[model samples]
Target: MRNNTGPYFIGNNTCMFSCWAPEKQKVTLRIVSPKERDIPMEKDDMGYFHVNVADIPPGAEYYFMLEGEKELLPDPASNFQPHGVHGASAVVNHHTFPWEDAAWKSIPLEDIVLYELHIGTFTEEGTFDAVIPRLDDLISTGINAIEIMPVAQFSGERNWGYDGVFLYAPHVTYGGPEGLKRLVNACHQKGIAVYLDVVYNHVGPEGNVLHRYAPYFTSRYKIPWGDAMNMDDRWADGVRDYISNNPLYWFEYYHIDGLRVDAIHTLYDSSAVSIWELINQKVKSLRETLGRPLYLIAESDLNSPRVTQQPIIGGMGFDAQWLDDFHHALYTLADSRGKRRYEDYGSMHQLAKAYTDGFVLSGEFVKFRKRRFGRSSAGVGGNHFVAFTQNHDQVGNRVKGERLSLLVDFERLKLVAGALFTAPYIPLLFMGEEYAEEAPFLFFCDHQNPELINATREGRKKEFADFRDEGEPADPFDRNTFLQCKLNWLARRQGRHAIMLRWYSELISLRKEHPALRSYNKDNIQAEVIEPGMLVIHRKSKDKNKVMVFLNFAEHDTTYRVPAGNVLWKKLIDSRDARWNTENIASAFLPSEITETNFVTVPAICIAIYTGAQ
Candidate 1:
């Protein structure tokens, strides 16, 4: 059946309304504005109700009345919601917006330095237009792409966007569809690609009317958020099409360069062709048809290289997958408390493994899961893995959503950033991470349901029972919590923040300028543990250019002897330099030739980089 879901303008002062509600005996298109009337829709053979209403101009308000019921429900495929989620849907003319990014093209996957930001908390104003003026700052900071958290219409004005219900509409509070298009166009003009984070594993509890309209959810598998999406069950084609078309809609209409699929680990599908494969195939087809680059990045904890492998090779064809093991291993090494998933990490060897190999748990027995987890990602290219020391989940999901700046010392923080940029995988930085902003990224939501709000509060306390002694977690329902997560722009020009920002800029510059540092081939990289808290990494390019990174995690000064080799090396970056507020413990330039007897003194928590001919 041809799926013509949502409102489409058929000209002549008329709009054709169609909805996929197979179970409903009778569906009525109730127009609430420009002459209110209940127009009965005719059901086709495919169980879809559609009707063409005359003189129903653009921006008209309407709803779906199922089974002749008096209670009106929002459209299952609403294109715009002027009011909040509970209110009536608005008719949006998608063709009216003037876009200016005709010459824009997406950045290559290997060249991407992703900066993930939430639209609601990225700036003081917390709106799409507010983010426009800050694009220059991000571009200057060396980020080539910006990944926005979801903006799908949710319950209230304030949310992290994970609780979105109306998949097609941008949140009205965040400037809606027009606001998003403007942001994307502005980003394209500045050579920065925009990636949107989308959640499809489960529908949010509040404002979700999908279950009432169709067989959109399944009860076979239980997810942390709610019931699983019915991707392979009875009458599942419409649901699958609805979910898959969302990415296409964003790419085609919003001109989104890529999509970061959230929590694919929880997306349960038992079918001949998995939902992921179907989505990937559709994305590939779209990219081919458009003759432009469109990427699909998945957030999966499976630690399997096949997640990004091509379907032709018997794997799901994702462009890249988040390498969370790298973050866990690095976080554990930085702070040895072994909190949450950190329990599976914390060893220096694991950090070294993450540097040499993409995944630390490659077919290894996991003590936490009590089972063998992950297959070997041996043949996977480093560019296929997106690595980050801190992201929204790592920071916001915490008891207080404390950033890395609050958890570690300044020196250690610089060292972490240095390690991340020098690694062989694509790097992602959380918003305000470059400047070391002090504001936290707390998990806040504005739910109108009092019962859901109370349940959320109790649920948060129960989840953090292990860390209760750390202090009480901020209430997710509190408006103050949302306000506290906003970025402090003034802090960027202040003392320590300014220095950190400079350090990040310099690191990014180095990464971009050096061929060896830009190489993402894991086989060309080597890592070794010098001691308990000291490590060395060497990256080599195809052109015989090489770069060596030395890290000292110890609390005291230590002399690191050069490995057994005779080579001419030049010092590039020293975290302990006076420019970064650290004591100058090492010389700016090292000896041109280093023998077995050559040794360099490195301060505590310092990172040093040197370049040499391979």
Candidate 2:
């Protein structure tokens, strides 16, 4: 299996172009840059056509011509699509980048506080270089890792990036390969790790020319996306290499520390070696050679069979996974406006169960699904799961793309952030969630086809009908839809927004600095419902340090007795600390410790943290 199948510079100003078209009788390499030169490609026995040509330097644009085809096709694995996805592929020399991150070593997965952001809406410039100046603010917020939404080339500029067609190319509008490399290098130098989100289940429908070149998709398995990939179908072996090489390309060329593989549930492979497993094995070998941490986090729920286990254990060997159950349970309680699938989550007890047990619905019957779902993840390490209250899917996929900050009160927002940080899993924050930005992260795209645009709008409205009281869901084709998602960075420095940012920063700091909060051992943590809309999470460190976090989701004050008849418990922080938020000023003067006899009245809709040596 080849690790590459694109234009590669073999010598100075000399390049070799490779294409996989076993069925084609005559495969021609048509270089359209510097000078129009058409070189008839010689096919090897293995179905790959290769030819080395001189004078084809970097930035040279090219396409492949198949026998009897009226139009030429871009390389299946083009590294740089200078124009849009339909444009000719530009040659990019991987060796040209002068990287200076030699001393860069990413932090452990267990210790990461991931901040997920979309490139188009992350800054006004909407380019990779624009994110460089914001690195300081991210680090100061206690984020060690930033997970970028997919930047793969799609139709036009604005997209959530799930519809990416060219797997290897970075979005041209986002400044392409060099821009991404510069961003990665800058992040590594600043002690920040960059993780890229990769979509491999299926390629985007528009500008997708893989069908013209080879058997890239199959109809054997049912998948939500138009066509399932040909992982276990004809030419499956070649397809595996093509899909597997994507992660390696990012790591080797762009210096990405991790990959968040999007939607593995759709990667259906009935072969002896599943495509997901094959990818894990390849990445593991690459990690060994590089002698660095390279995490593969699946965008699948814990229900997917053996997703986080090692290959030796008859598993897919993903390092971690995104657990949506935590988000559902917490979001349902905080925002009663949730619909459809959220009907399964309402009780605070479920959120508590999600905290203690890795999956609340573990092997249990799900009312929403009308069947048993999710094997028990009770034994899984908390580090094996990434938990958050909201992510891109939760926010951007909404009919209106309303952020959690907009749905809940200011105090409840603080409460949820505390819950996320203190929970026994790696925490993630969506862009501008730290400051509670008023702007929504709406679903958007800039597809060139008017027919596809009309279809997309209709499909979105139908999608919302399943779970929401539908008005016309935001008009995705509107340029305003894309522009509205841009983050208000200035808002972060003003009034309540600044306070919320500080609140998030402080919570993240405590999660990092405090021993009890840092430990991801679910066994050392106890999450229980104190009463309706009230919860308490007690954590103990291996070093005998103890912390108890009280979360009150109710709008009214609730009195509770400390379970442990404490001699002395040091109050570390309160979400409603009047000094920071300027609310509940009278209650801020409470003592350092309180016994079980003294009924502690937790402020309405507040989060309070306490610590003591156990």
Candidate 3:
């Protein structure tokens, strides 16, 4: 293991050093400079040694001492380490950074169009400050919130940042805690709300030292990784406080707008009272103190109402949940392919159910589970759910890790994109999907253990036994896998990819312009299956604004009749043309461009949007 060696500064010239060295009978702080000096430390009750150095300053280098062994180790809870992950901890003066977003306001989650991106894969440079330049791109796309993947501190130089051990510390490999602060400040200045995805279910399998000094993990319930977080077990109050304080720290110290709770289904708690309520209380308290509307989003498979229901209704106070059923239905229906999770979906009925009830599998027999599963959320508001046609897990967990572009034709991709933007729910897009970038989003980690690495490879093989022959599996720990996932900035300006990017930008613009297209009320939304390969979604607003969306998934044209109504219709937007040109699709129609009985032929795998004339 690498040790930190520094004349480092921590809280002025005098600094404190503490680390858990249970394996060593004796430990010494070896100052390997000028004249080698051995400094002894007093072991605390938690098997950690602590001593304060009187001569160290802000940029000094240092390391730890262990049982006659000399190794430099960084502070286990380092706020900043400019040298390396294994180098001396540097003191970060947080008050020094000049902030210009003092009047920065937060956009409520109810009115947000979120865009989820992994900072490492979002740009070629893959750093916090590097992502600052792309704020204009997101703002132009009409995205109100940016949900970054986990930034928690993890071991090694590169990772997804989920296996973080230091709950309060940002990853040292990615410019540490201060870098994240700068990013958040910059985002606030650009009027973009920053929401970070956090992993509280389980820590990663690396330099996780929390188990040594605190009861952070429990053996009572088994999670995907090692041990489950001790949410409700013995000595858990402190643990819960630690976990809850983490988000508060982010919101208070870092000025983050909200947090996306990762995979809440695995957050097992055998307590009689709801543990979700406890978290909600903590969030409420923090929001009161911060004087801002803080938000929480849960990614759960269970169709339990408690996840999104209001606290006054004896439910958890999460603002929204990730609606995966919508994606699965859209995936199964649009591509006409999917065997695993999509096995129970793809019917126009299921798609209709998803649009009306929020979840298609609500208490229905699902072929994939071989059991009746989920509950219908019929009366819920669409704004209480986040829907996407494709996401990080759907695209990255595949054997080949190819996005929708690899499985289906390009037309189908555009059709799904149209559905995503114009749907009743809040829409989100995965990175690079707007321009149709071909690079795959594969699982890439920087694990040091060889056995763990081999097990990861084998586990992936077993998980995709039925789908393995599609393509070769890329090693998740390989540096090349991470490199390949980076977005090709030039792809947005070349050929068909550029056309796809423009189409996305235009659809988003239209959605923002038309209130009828973006209403979140389920009652205001209606859809009908015209045929096996065609469906139409109609949205009606109180302002007498109404729009109809036609989606054709077959490889041949399908003619759709306008509903029998008392008003004329006018074309609004169509995804058939190379650039969504409304000039022809809007100006000409079979029935003089304004008739209740006009029939229009929707091209193969195309989408058309039309509005009722005022």
Best by TM-score: 2
Which TM-score value belongs to model 3? Answer: 0.87
Task: Tell how far residue 287 is off in model 1, in angstroms.
Answer: 1.2
Error of 3 at 387 (Å): 0.9
Residue range 104-218, candidate 1, lDDT tens digits: 8789989989999999999888899999999999988899899999999989889999999988889998999899999999999999999999998877779888988889988
Full candidate order by lDDT, most accurate first: 1, 2, 3
After superposing candidate 1, which stretches have Cα over 4 Å from the reference? 1-3, 10-13, 338-341, 564-566, 582-597
**Residue 115's C-alpha lDDT in candidate 1?**
96
Counting clashing residue pairs in each candidate, in order, gives: 0, 0, 19
Q: How accurate locally, in lDDT, is each candidate? A: 0.86, 0.86, 0.74
Q: After superposition, how far is residue 90 of candidate 3 from its true place, in Å?
A: 5.3
* Candidate 3 lDDT for residue 23: 44
| Model 2 vs. true fold: TM | 0.97
Error of 2 at 58 (Å): 0.7
TM-score of 1: 0.96
Of the two candidates 1 and 3, the one with more favorable TM-score, higher being better, is 1
Residue pairs with clashing backbones, model 1: none
* Candidate closer to the true structure by lDDT (higher is better), 1 or 3: 1
